[model samples]
Target: MDAGALAAALAAARRRTLSLFDALAAAGYDDPARLPRLSIVNPPLWELGHAAWFAEWFVLREATGSSPGEAGGASLLAQGDALFDSGRVAHAARWTLGLQPEVIKSYCGAVLKAILARLSHAPDDDAALYPYRLALAHEDMHGEALLYTLQTLGAAAPVEEDVADWPAAAGEIAFAGGAFQRGGDQSRGFVFDNEKTAALLTVAPLTIDAGLVSNAAYLRFVQDGGYDDPGHWSGAGRHWLAQQGRQAPRYWRRAGDDWTGIRFGRQVALDPAAPVRHVTLHEAEAWCRWAGRRLPREEEWEFAAHSGHPGFAWGQLWEWTASPFLPYPGFTPDRYREYSAPWFGSRQTLRGASFATAPRLRSPRYRNFFTPERDDIYAGFRSCAL
Candidate 1:
């Protein structure tokens, strides 16, 4: 909660978000017609405005006791809440919101200016900096969302010239049963409500994959008619398979003896060494069943990650786990109550970060939740010994 450092980080995050918007605009992905009617993908223009609105609402308005949408409130935009309040705005209606790119940019700029001005005079205490940190974290999440949205739309990938090459780790790593703490450490600063109330849990002796499952390995599942067999799928998973009529990962396609995938709109030959991306929890579970393995529980995944076990590679793709998204034993909602409580029972938990994840926002302790059927994200999986 160092105000100066946090301000700098917020500025950098906003810049990255704007750059992504510029890339999407250049590729004509800004057109409403280009986006699918999916709940997961938000309109780029609306998303930009919403991110700004969230910052303005929390930092400038709510933190100061002014209602967000009231006239004579602190919001810079007259209709900011009406245009971008995600809770009230229906997902299907975002595409038709009629927000212009320039207007959205202006709103974002104004909001950032207001936030920085407040930060300059704000105290360095946790109470004073909590809202600003929350806003910054919110923006970072949206930035990652934008990248995955580009993937969903088949748009060109953003150029990352400085991305370092990470070779996949080899072999399974074993861990002995022990008591391990699960959930965020508040002393480390700015954790989401869902990650609160750290508790110790006993873990069983287990062996887990050192790296994520690769595209070549997933290809074998597809070749074996994994999708057609109900034996490997859960009841809900089988229903999902029937509804989507899916045979493989969302972007994958086959030609003769070879396989290729759509990456940032361009079709490229599948890399056997690369971690498989865009697979659902259902698909991951089925693959594990096919191989006579099982997806690792969230605690096990966290244990391996925190222990820094040799050859345990992550931060390439968001890895799915066996655990359901639920609260820790003594969970209590933070000031921003809506963040995690709503999605607790229905979604599956994902551990680790993806290449598109902002480095500042990632940690082994961070918990990401999504429904089991969501495969559009840059997500993959690893397995444990049965």
Candidate 2:
């Protein structure tokens, strides 16, 4: 993106950051002393400051030859590196950091002001604007995480735009696949390090569902004893099922005959037309097994998304792929060393966007990932014929 587009996107992302922080504060996450310590979540005050610090680190510091290694400049926040550098700070340690909400809020404003000031003068070239783009994407990513955190915490949630891309999983689409480009191009600009390794891969012709599996369909699996049967589950699925002790999707509850899902903090009837969300890869796998189908390999998913199938739909929720989160052949770490390298082989790749995802971040090439056991994310799946 050019300077103007980057500036506008950055500003919009910062506004979203502040709004999520406000919602967190209103829900008492600003003081997390009473909250249970979950390995999956972050402290609200730390996340607020860390988001700002990352932008400053990327746009204001690294862009100026101050890498994370070399001594560059002092942070606007006193002891900021000690406070906000995620690599330096451990997750459990964040709770004991003794940060003040008012102070972190001030730091957030200051960092954005500096970030905009820097972006105003940067050259419009892709090389020059890469850091700004990274910062924008990073904050946008965190904004989605914060929304899900609110949902996990049962706090107030953001007002989302309608994400109904289609009425149902409009049957299946057959793709006679051959060579497919599996990753992003540098020319496209702002490609993530993980997605930058381009490869023309040959994939078998596959048939995949035109739309995501709906809540109604998944409920049928639950009612049919899919979870209890264990025969439909993989070993990992069984382990996760036993660990979670779950019979339905993470947020689901049944009242008499009707199934309701808890979204954000409110419980509402499950929408038959809407994609099933907050489901783990294990659950998705079990459902696929029950239906005599399989999760689409990421290649098939990429192919199908680009095939221009009029009935195909996505972006209502993140869709799981059968592929594991492995690096492409020529993969290398980007400036942010920990972003993709650390979790390789351990996480599952999710595609598409969710209602919580920012519109600017929505792209078929964007690879979302998480541990297979995580049902806290807004995720679902569509199946492919075995």
lDDT of 1 by residue, 1-386 (tens): 59999999999989988988777888776777776678888888888888888888888875432234432354687777878878778889889877888878988998899889999999888878988899999999999899888777777656871233354566798888788777888775788888878888788899999999887788899899988899999998999999999988888888788988888777787888778889999999999999999999999998888886768888998999999999987888776667888899999999999988888888888999999999888799999999
List candidate 1 stretches off by more than 4 Å: 64-72, 161-167
CA shift at 327, candidate 1, in angstroms? 1.0
Model 2: residues >4 Å from true position, as ranges? Answer: 63-68, 160-166
Q: RMSD for each model, in Å, please?
A: 2.2, 1.8
Q: What is the TM-score of each candidate against the true structure?
A: 0.94, 0.96
lDDT values of the candidates? 0.84, 0.85
lDDT (10s digit) by residue, model 2, range 1-386: 78988889998998888888788888888886955689988987888889898888877777343245544577888988898888889888988999998898888888888888888888879888888999899999998888878889998765652233345566888888878787898775789988978888787888889888988889899989998999999999998888889999889988898988786787777788878889999999999999999999887888788667787788888999999999988898887878999999999999988878899888888899999999888898999999
